[model samples]
Target: MSASTPHRPVRADAERNVARILEAAKVVLAEDPTASLERIADEAGLARATVHRRFASRKALLEALVAQLNEQYLRALHEAKVDSAPPLIALHRVTELVMEIKFSHRLVMDVVTAGTPARWSYLSAEVRERAELLFARLHASGAITAAHPSWCLKIYLAILDEVHHLPAGAPELASCADEVTARTTLQVTTVLGALGGAPLPH
Candidate 1:
């Protein structure tokens, strides 16, 4: 930590190379689950040896990508400020954001949900606790009518799991970006309304 000590610098070329490899792997993996490491390296304009040096292996690359995505999700949750919003609105907004992420990265979400060994299955406990707290507030406020507050968690997971794996040709629902979101929202809203002590506002 002395001022006289030399500070080690990461070479700009190496930094760029790592960034390129991550970007290329994301694109290639979306299109082809079994995308070759060599092709990914070529796509990133790096040699196979360099890609290996950066990622070590395909599994390492995927795990890194998943970690990056988790960070993004955490940032989004923070920005949404769900805790400050009204309970029901907060729940809806959180669900909407989750759906948005799923739609944008359908392939990656699917791969992870399908028990991909390299990816983590759920968000960090802090995120989950925030969500559960929102649901508990909603339950207490009579925004939703669940005999047991834990039922909200069950419904939330069901919606997320179903929407994440929606088929390519599903029928469209109203007021949604696509058939998947629309139908999912409709089904989830209905269930929430039933469990929610009060009727949904028009």
Candidate 2:
């Protein structure tokens, strides 16, 4: 078997089955972390055995889902290209993008929050480094004024935490998640502005 060859092209039915499984898992897991694999298979309209065949185990399925969501989120961030935009606008855009992803894939956010520190430690080095670089560039350009470089990370994590664990059944909050996100963005920018950073032109 070669790397280029999957031994064979996946059959259409199997492809559909896998896609359905992933989609169903995403929906159920986002709503409830304790959702069972059997429930996921049922939602996918597939046999439990079929789900197992594709995912091997529950852990494998969850890991695959998290990885998929992470990749998509990263792609969105890259497309946003905050570094190329004005510092305050970049912050707002990036924050909005992250909150959108978190809302859509709440399971990933839950897993990261619930997991041991070691599980998420890997993100700090790679993802945090890039974020810090973006913040540092903005600070250098007078887009944000922070006496300490670590403030950027603190602010980013705070916003992410609030968005990720939004209260349930609060239609008021749910309805205003977008507005809340926007307001939060502006508030952060204002604080940064107070630090002597100039706002980017709208």
Candidate 3:
């Protein structure tokens, strides 16, 4: 599950370096999923030995990346305020936050969700509950159908994935920034408009 909490004991400096490596890995690997750990070390401005000291092997590095991705995603889900906001409004905000995470951490997301029986889904309990409630709210508002409320929630996430179609061969990854936020919202709104009647007002 993408929302799994990580537990590891390390010195403060080593923890900071690990965090840096994971962040740099996101950008480097998003551009080239096959990028060498040497390249990641360069991006993080650290010695290759330093990265290897923290992560013994490429698989270990990737596992750390996935753990970091899960932490960031859980944070985003909590920050989305899905329960407190109005239905469509909440959905819009959630989509924006999610897209920001997805675009920035594209490679780690692919690693996590790559195979059959994907490791990623509505993994967080709070997120899943809030999503179902939001779907019910949207159904009541005629934004989604009356039947199969949970299915609607799944469809919402599926649509989000579909609309995030990255180009082939090492496209530059977008950061979780204001510009990317706006772009994701616009693109997703265009896609969801087809099903949910019209797009929500900007």
TM-score of each: 0.75, 0.71, 0.65
lDDT of model number 2 = 0.66
Model 1 lDDT, full chain set = 0.67
Q: Kindly list the per-residue Cα lDDT of model 1 for residues 60-144, writing each as its tens digit.
A: 8877777766766666566656678776666666666766666667665644434454233456666666767777787778777
TM accuracy, model 3 = 0.65
lDDT of 3 by residue, 12-70 (tens): 67889988998888888778878888999999999999998988887788777656666
Off by over 4 Å in 2: 1-15, 118-126, 147-151, 163-187, 190-202
In model 1, pairs of residues that clash are 144-196, 144-197, 145-195, 145-196, 145-197, 172-179
Q: Kindly indicate the candidate among 1 and 2 with the higher lDDT.
A: 1
Tens-digit lDDT string for candidate 2 (16-62): 78889989987877777788889899989899999989888788887
How many residue pairs clash in model 2?
0
Better of 1 and 2 by TM-score: 1
